[model samples]
Target: MRTSRALASPAPSPQEIGRAATLALHDELALSPKPGLVTLTDRGSHADMDAHTFMRSLFALRSYFVRIAELGAAQAPFEALEACGIAAEARMLAATQGINTHRGAIFMLGLLCASAGSLAARGLRPTVDGLRHTLTQRWGEALARRALRPSALPGGQAASRLGLRSASAEAALAFPTLFETAVPALRAARSRGLASGPARLDTLFATMAVLDDCNLAHRGGLAGLRFAQGCARDFIAAGGAGRPDGLAAAAALGAEFVARNLSPGGAADTLAAACWLDRLG
Candidate 1:
């Protein structure tokens, strides 16, 4: 519910812009953690280290939410990492006793990152009051069920149907494409080459490699998402006998953005990924 303007883009350069984004993210993580809860800030402490990591992870919940909510699947590799952490805690909390307090705290943080207002709102206010209703209705129920059922994760049949499973699989397969194809293609297009992105190559590249694969697999129904893998394959190549890259519609917009009329080296690929997800939705 904090009010602040998103840092304007058309930024100095991809390096500068992404650096700022990363710093902002870390800042959010530092400030808004769950009070009196174990967290990353407690790292290296002798006591409650694991609990601290779990809770510290929660403290930065807003950063996680803002990243996913604003960036969508394209740039969501960052968010997915956090989401997985939350999933792990949720599972642990369900099975273990004497940690109910920490369990509820983690769940609230998860809702903050996963629900409508969390990722869907794009740095705006959390709107998916549907989340609040669901939490109120099912959180305790889920806890009770976990006790009897002994299953750690929630969402039942709904999780797979929601496409996280598929996305996870798809993201697995997307590595060759993202690194071999997309990154190379953009580097060739850019005058900057690898120099344009020392920082992003390590973090963003690895993250995008995962996210793109997941988004494709899950078809998580992102906004502005459409296009297929092979659809743009020919376009990325040298002379396709027609257009350079055959990206059209959402894909075309993505390609152009990747080509640098948009933001940075990875921006176009990420944006295109976003466009494709939008179509699925």
Candidate 2:
């Protein structure tokens, strides 16, 4: 779907970028209380997670996201894969899923969130989808830029990156990568008759609404989503069951951001999570 609305105009300038980076660093340092394991309580109880633990998880997740924003700004192919020490995977995802680092980040994050929901599709520590997404977006964007131009990327590709380039081709939905990431879970929800079409719209709206309810400005509290997603990711890595309430909270907040940006059409993942949480609630 066409995104008539843009991502809330990116932080005004590089100064803002610096501030964001600083804040992100601060948040990660704060999560040191919870080290490796993230606990998600099933009943009306939560494992005692302290500030430090939370910060560590946040720090790890930050790398996953900043890499995304950076990829979005990339201009070449060689640099893309090398952006985060992940060039080969970018090529693989591109070949298999038509995803570059730009699109891959979204696809991967969505997959992580969805996998977290299931929690035990396998007993192994699940791959951190967000991390993979970051690697993909970095390289993909570099590749996209290379395809757009003919130049040595951060690294550069020998051959052109495009298999098909059509003026009529829809611009890839790489923005809001989570939309792509969340597609599988969204589809499963629909197949199980657990969701409404474009269900993510409601989830996005609901997310924004909840944030509004808590007096958290969308810009200010976006970190909360990052933090929460990190916590969820770590929990899954430790084989913890999904937290229905946490899932709902994340979806509701996601909806809020999309609704405010006027791109509610791309909320399939958010809504699907909301449906799952609602059912599990």
The lDDT of each candidate is: 0.31, 0.31
Minimum summed lDDT over a 10-residue window in model 1 is located at: 30-39
Worst 10 residues of 2 by lDDT: 37-46
Off by more than 4 A, model 1: 1-177, 192-227, 237-281
- TM-score between model 1 and native: 0.25
Candidate 2 local Cα displacement, residue 246, angstroms: 12
**What value of lDDT does candidate 1 attain over all alpha carbons?**
0.31
Off by over 4 Å in 2: 1-54, 60-68, 78-177, 180-281
Residues 1-281, model 1: lDDT tens digits = 75543443221222222233333223222321211112235221123334444444334432433343333223334345346546545545544422432332233233323333222333332222333443334233433333343223332222244443322222233223433443344444343333322212222323233333322322223221123233233333323212323213323434433332121112223323222221212
- TM-scores of all predicted structures: 0.25, 0.24
Query: Any idea how many clashes model 1 has?
Result: 28
